[model samples]
Target chain A: MSQAVPSAQRTSLAVPTQVALAGVFAALIAVCSMLPPIPVGGFGVPITLQTFAVMLTGLILGARLGFLSVLLYLVVGLAGLPVFSGFNAGIGVLAGPSAGYLLAFPLAAGLAGALSTVVLRRGQAAAARGAGRMGFGWWALVWLCAMVASFVFIHPMGIAGMMLALDLDLATALGADMVFWPGDVVKNVLATAVAATVIRAFPALALRRF
Target chain B: MNLLDHRPGTSPVHRAPLGVKYAVLLVLTVVLVAWRQPVVVGAVLAGVFGLYLLARLPGEFLAPWRRGWPLLAFAGVARFASGVFGPVPLSPLDALGPALVVMAAVFGALAAARLLVITTPGTELLDGLAHFFGAFRRFGVNPEAAALAVNVMLRTIPWVGAAVRAHAEALASRGLRRGPVRLMGPVLVATVGHARATGEALAARGLPAAPEPKHPGPDYTRGA
Candidate 1:
């Protein structure tokens, strides 16, 4: 059953390929960040598609590239490309109220990628035990991992940033951040579905050390 | 597809070395953000305007601000309301002044950053950054790879934007009302596919594995 796995899945990518993938995903993240926000329920921070893009990058690109891609996006935005939410850019945006959330992007991507890799390895092991193609189960695990990563990394860092910038107590900051939960669930689900589809289409999509 | 804010020009701002311009921009932004006084903020705004003129930016360069008008209005209105109706009330006049000053500082900072973007081409800016980070190469960091990544990112941004628009339209035409959300899967698949193809192309070009060092100055370890 292990022999049934595609050769591409086991093969490692060249360094250039890894770098290019990271760059491309970084560009995608920037584009997503720059998209006009969809105002949700009058919260000052509008719902942007950036988180979804970050998660997708993580799941598809794997840990190292996922982290690099997001970090690159932040660097580009800070370098003044108007790539931040609402087309605002520069170091000030990073230093401003949303700084925590901004800073957490790379960490969120890293955690998501790491968790996905762990789940994927487990799925492969199961496949080696004569289990059928690790199809829906793999995707479900990916979704769960992405959600957990978001909960652990993105939200906490974001709330902390909000507290500092807004001068709100932890409870107040959490309350303000709570409005994003429902929307984030939808975004994470969408990202997982997209990533799963991409991986299924290209068995060698995820990054592996060369 | 026109993702870059830089416009082709021969103004002093364009001619100035990237480092000097960026250094000035950084210092100015720091000062603007640090000084909350109306006078300081106003002076910074005026100085930014002067630089804008010197940079020879077209009226269209300011077009990005139109998007912020509603936010600016909301900020003003919200500030006024809070001052008048809060537990410790204040005169509308007092509240309005602070709100306007805050708004002005924000606008000034944004304009200053935009000016930097508008005058600097992406490649030059990245090269400048790569040079700045080249100092870290001694610590086993590959600044060249980082620079290449940034270059690829800058070049690919417009392509990604176009892909999103094309994907969204394709979905809409297929009767998917929520095109953007529905767009996620297809776009990701397409983007990954494109990246793979790009990677293959770059490999095919036989680009050297190690980029040549920009400044191969004195090799002390090599008996220099």
Candidate 2:
């Protein structure tokens, strides 16, 4: 486990370990979706920490596991668990306004998770060079990765989903989706902070080599 | 186990093979999304409702709406607005009509999925999924692992909820609970640590994912 160990000595995650981690992380996400809404704005929009959980899963689990976990969560929901926001379930979600966002989540998690792995590996290298571990710079970079995934993947998919499902034009779809931008930004920020703490406590959680 | 409410019965719906039920649901979902005609979606919804009755699963007539209204309302308002305000505006009736049809599609799909769960036992689901995954053996995909992953996900959900509740209570007892963000970090850490422990236990058990992980023993594609 030491850095001095040769690359040949590196341990890859076995199939069972990978599957268990993915499943547990997926359940964590489902629970996050069911967590009580923050009661934001009093209008009953019903915001949950699910978005934060989504981003953090990516940042902490890296690409494959992160993608698998989110995909598992969706499959469970579509198979009839009320694990979606507002406790929605089933394949109908794919044809609804939330379809775009929900479908985009696995991709977004993969993109964010990939970026996080790169950031952590590079950060670990820097730490080995005496820069220390998961510093403020590392946190900011991780946060940037999550934000990039959110902005680049989730919004566009959501808008497209709305346009397709609701028969809306691009302008209208974008307008409707824009309402949640601020909240997404806050969630990404919180996700990075949480992920940073997680990696610090369990360095092997995201990357095996520290 | 109670999460799915799998009512026991010998009805045709219950006796139907899992794959057929799944295929029907999948087909209906795609058709429902593509066809916006209220007449068609309504027919499918009624058919699904009838299946519920036939199965003796008269579980709750209002159950679908209880879980479905929020999603319907959201989609309905958006579809209604889009129709009224689009570049080539729809007539009020046209707008209102398709919007309702789309709502039917959503509800129909949800009900179909619910029906699948109601008639099928959870173990059947796992076996079915494993059988489905068995097709990917050449790609290094372990069928049992996929099934086990889903099984673990089902078991882990409640534990996660309990962990979050415990975290909240502990924070409240110490008066350190501040905002939503505070408990999240600790909950994630605890859950992940638990995952690691579970992974270690699974790895130590090393049961080979069945009679084989890399190689197939018998063709147990006997699907549920």
Candidate 3:
């Protein structure tokens, strides 16, 4: 039942709708970020669902809008919205120990979205090649990409921010940041699984020209 | 859904222009960071309280901090614990100074930001943002798009929140106690489905399309 609509036939949304989608995702991110963090005893770096929402933004919205969605969230929070983790806000939140992770959000979403487009495109090509089994591989690739983005973008920046804001050396900073890895892995895996399930149920979603 | 704690008032702080309030908040936050002294942080915290009072916010406005104080206390204790196990053990008094400073600065910053949010309505905040970013229009930035996004997000927060709660309850009723994780799949499906429907609605309305580039550049960068 899948019709291959030409990219030309698919219309770009109205500016208002695009903005609305971005805003919706931004609010999603904020809600996720501000949810009462799972209290991990020391260092106060609570396990947060912000990363999960970030990955979902990329996987669902594509790159440009994904990036803008996150950028908008950050701008609003910095503009004195009580939307940051622990109900915090202001430019000072960016100056705090968690700044690295916070600042890396847009880049993380952009990377995840770009990687998702590539992976889904390849999956579609493979499916056309009569290799339906490759669908599982593509799903795995989506998860891998999310994990890699977190490691490459979120963790490193977070460690650096911790180092500067908390005044700890590299080793200590790394130690502090390591606490969130397990939770992050779980969150990203869930994000990947959810995205894969949604795309499978709505094949047209995978066919969109990002 | 009640994302902003803003209480309508005719107080001077509430009457001041959004830009001026933002400017004042920025200056105060800068000084707090730069000074990093207990006295400075304490003074700023006091100033924020004064502004809160000036805005005539109800006493309950600070109620959220009741749940927050324990965490702040834990933070101070964690610092002292870290100091004791450090390469060079710090005396309790020495550890206490830095801990208090960190706590005070954080508390002060949070108070100041809350005050801003508490006084400014969400719509006015979005308008201020649109105005603030208007200057960037010359650089190809779109302030209307940005404002629209923020506005949409403000509206969606409650919708998504309710969806999550509803999904969680559905899962729980089905004998799945571990609801949140299991709820993710359904929530994602529903949200993506809603987004697609929204797109279709926009298309059906015949919204104007963005102009195509004359050069017809390579499609390699389509997703980027």
Candidate 4:
């Protein structure tokens, strides 16, 4: 009882706040998919809002709970709810070309969230004067961490899905992976840029409501 | 099988037991996986589309596709590009048939799923899942937390989606929408803080603790 509320001034939030934020992040993933994507090239993979959703879920929800959120989305999709990109769902999707990416959502979210937390802690401590004043280089490092995780974990799973479903060899699959890269990179850059801006304007956006 | 809380009006599919429905969906998915031939896959697609009609699912039910179709197209293109650019040497024409068929099948199945979910309430699905996995207690799993996990996931997906958009719109108002890096940076920060707080809350509530195991033998407790 002597905990004295642990000084809410720090990073963590109360229980109700966490639930509220989790709900908010999940909803953000869904809405991000709804906005029309601007296609980058002939490969047809336009940079959509999915990365922002997955990364934010991980960065905010952490490894376990963040995984839970993406898993829930997948379950909802499997159960026939249209929570996926384009609002499509069902078991058939699990076997299709995109199955790998679909399956990777939770894993990707978990990886990104875990990696980002490390950066967040370090960044917070380093930026001792005024919570909002983050060194630009540190912000760049956080971006690199997120991008690397997505590229390493999510993309490979996605390629495997393509290979298995499409009966393509690794080379062929890599080709497909390349197509998604440019567009995804663009999305990541955009997501990160917007994320930084939000922090600048509403530092509260940087704080967890959960 | 409905995951979202929205159960539609009375229908045979909606009324079916969640376990049975999930089993059927799983079996069908396995069958789809087992059969790779385009003819078989096409047949499955046709059958799924037929089911959509049978369920009386509305055209607007495919509403999410308005935004999603492009992503599917991109993926399809990526598949073909990989085939052509890489050592595989698959003709674009060859890739198109399977890609479109796969996309159609996926969309159809999702459409069917959407109809069912929008109709069924979430609580029913949770209770059904809890009862179905009731035996997992032996593994030190709390059926309640497991069930709650499912519920929270279902509840939050749409929530996170809305938050991302609101953040983006707010950003856009200030004339800031060029790359995901810029957009997601703050969102990530906000998200991490939220996750930590959430974990703390669950801990405070005495969660992460396993529930009592179910009785193992035939000569069980009082209920037996």
Candidate 5:
């Protein structure tokens, strides 16, 4: 198992292990979503903190890791793990009204993390290593990348699912889920701020190598 | 194999390969989704429940379903209630049937997964995933890292749950655990810190970008 990389490099979390952790995180999200929540009307979709976990998957795990995590969630759910809102599972849920949203999770996380690598760390890391000026700005890019990812990738798919599943008119679904929009905005901002703050306080949070 | 529910005994269902079990589970789920007929759904549920009994799973193993029942009940009731109060003279019964079936199907799936997880140790499951996804190098992921990540993640589940619980318990012991604003702030701060530390520990040990280890398998791709 040893390689030219230092013990730290050779002993880091392996990719397959990352994939499994993603599944576990997905399960955790499902369990957390099951906790009592701010219920919306007839739809039964509540405002839960699970979305934050999804965001965290991307912000911390990076793009591929984040997507793999969500994928793991889907696989387990498909395998009948009660890892969804309301402790629900099975392929039916994946094809049900909420299926689209579920499908979008990995995308959102991946886009967020991947974009962060580009937007957050790309220029700064190169500069920092050259000039020895690594700072919170790099961390801020990671958060900003996550925010953009959610906006571009996650919410649209969720709204699309709501429209298709509920048979709502696009405009109406958009408006109704506007409630989600505001809350999500808050979640994204909070996630960004929290992520940056964590990285600053613990620079190692940004490190993925062993 | 360690069970999350902590029961013990090896049976065919217990010993089935993760991939085969997953394939069966996927096929059943697809069948359930494709056919919405109550008769079909009921039959499937009945059959799965029969397997459950055959597996000799105790009543305790179904406890997680109890946690979800209230939500299912609420969803069912809310749907019916909307039908009742809505200006449209909607029949509550119409909503009731689909809602119940959906809920039951969901419960069925969870029950099945519970059987799998309870019988399989987390480590063994990760090994299964690594082998299952051993072909991911074509897609740019190092198979070994992917496997390691999966294991790390599974190992952290109990720890994350415990961490969250310990924090909540500490707050409760101090007569706190109120207000989403106040409660989530510390809990989230703690979680992020923990997740980061864990990630860093993995990284410090050369995880994320580590070169793949040698293994006895088909050499599908070059390792870094």
Candidate 6:
């Protein structure tokens, strides 16, 4: 324990810190999905704050760590923790139509994160030193990142999965997929706003690369 | 099944090493992917279910099906509609027949994993994973880091619950009220604080909590 290791004082996060950050975000994703306050419950409908947490994870953590975080959550849930949306878990969910979207989470988080670093203009060299304010334009771009990841990757994959698992045609799956659009947009906004606020409060949290 | 739902047992399955159970799960997944024959997959499903009962667990062996019925019903209806209305007009039974077999294979894999979790203690599972990951030390991976993260996650779940309650009460006293937006902001802030604290703790314990700078800072490379 006495070895300072000299790595702790670096501008970038240490390896254990990075891993811990990812784990924290993964837990956050699980808590949001399984939140009792807004339980999706047994309705089997997919809308929940989980997506918000997932988006926030990307916006705050950036690509590599973001993907790692969500992937960790997925692995844990698959290991049988009832950590998925609506408090459901296990590999059985893979058989469900939403399995595609569930599987697409890490990719979506990574893509959103890849876009956020550019959109936020956070530097690669050093962590932001103090509280920093982001403009509405920045928030919009981050929102766009989350939204694009959701619509472009996660939703389409979900539709394709439903098509395969449920044997539905493209048109039918598209209709079902549309139901999530409005809730998702609102969620993306909340996630973006929260991410902006967190960064504002702690500029170092604005997602700089190691 | 939930981790909290684990029931202790002395059955061979329960007594088996996690490595053995994990290997079985891996083999099932690899075989399922490599083969398409429903009969082969279905046979494996039967064996897993039989093992579940043989272990005397406290639930229906068909619990996966029961939990997934809404999805099952929805798929059945959708396939039926497509069969009758599509231009090609195939029989509903014919369409659903293939999907069911495939989905069952998928769930069977899940159930097998669940059985492993249900029979094993959480710590044992974590230890098994830590051991498994330890072999990759040459690859720059810290196996214990992952297991530690999971430990923090499970431990922090209770903290999340407490934070929500405290935040709600504080918000109510000030007449600020609580909605997803207001509620989420502070909760996230708290969780972030939690992360920072955990990072600091890990660092103090001499774990690599922060990454090394690509270009060393002045103090970083100073020699004795």
Q: Please name the candidate that would achieve the greatest lDDT relative to the true structure.
A: 2
Candidate 1 chain B, run of 10 with poorest lDDT: B71-80
Put the candidates in lDDT order, highest first.
2, 1, 6, 3, 4, 5
Chain B alone vs. reference chain B, TM-score for every model: 0.76, 0.87, 0.79, 0.63, 0.68, 0.76
Q: Report the C-alpha lDDT of model 5 over A30-54, residue by residue, as the tens digit.
A: 5455566665447665677677767
Best by TM-score: 2
Docking class of 1: acceptable
Order the candidates by DockQ, highest first: 2, 1, 3, 6, 4, 5
Report the C-alpha lDDT of model 6 over B31-100, residue by residue, as the tens digit. Answer: 6544647798888888888878877874746665666565556655565566556556677667666556
* DockQ of all models, two decimals each: 0.40, 0.60, 0.38, 0.27, 0.20, 0.36
Best by DockQ: 2
TM-scores for chain A over all candidates: 0.87, 0.89, 0.86, 0.81, 0.74, 0.83
Ranked by DockQ, the better of candidates 1 and 6 is 1
- lDDT per model, in order? 0.73, 0.78, 0.72, 0.61, 0.59, 0.73
The 10 consecutive residues of candidate 4 chain B with the worst lDDT sum are B1-10
Candidates' TM-scores? Answer: 0.80, 0.89, 0.83, 0.68, 0.65, 0.80
Residue-level lDDT of model 3, residues A1-210, one tens digit each, is 133334465455556567667777887788788666654436655677888899888787777778888988889888767677777666656535667888999999888888887788777666766655346778889888888888889999998875554444566567667878887887788788878777777765555456
Per-residue alpha-carbon lDDT of model 3 for B1-224, expressed as tens digits?
36666778899988999888888877886676567677887888788778878888757446445635664564455445555555667888887787777667656665666677777787788778878777787787776556655666776777777877888889888888753457777877776666556555645755324434568867996697
How does model 1 fare in lDDT?
0.73
Poorest 10 consecutive residues by lDDT, candidate 1 chain A: A163-172
lDDT, residue B24, candidate 1: 80
User: What is candidate 4's CA lDDT for residue A147?
Assistant: 90
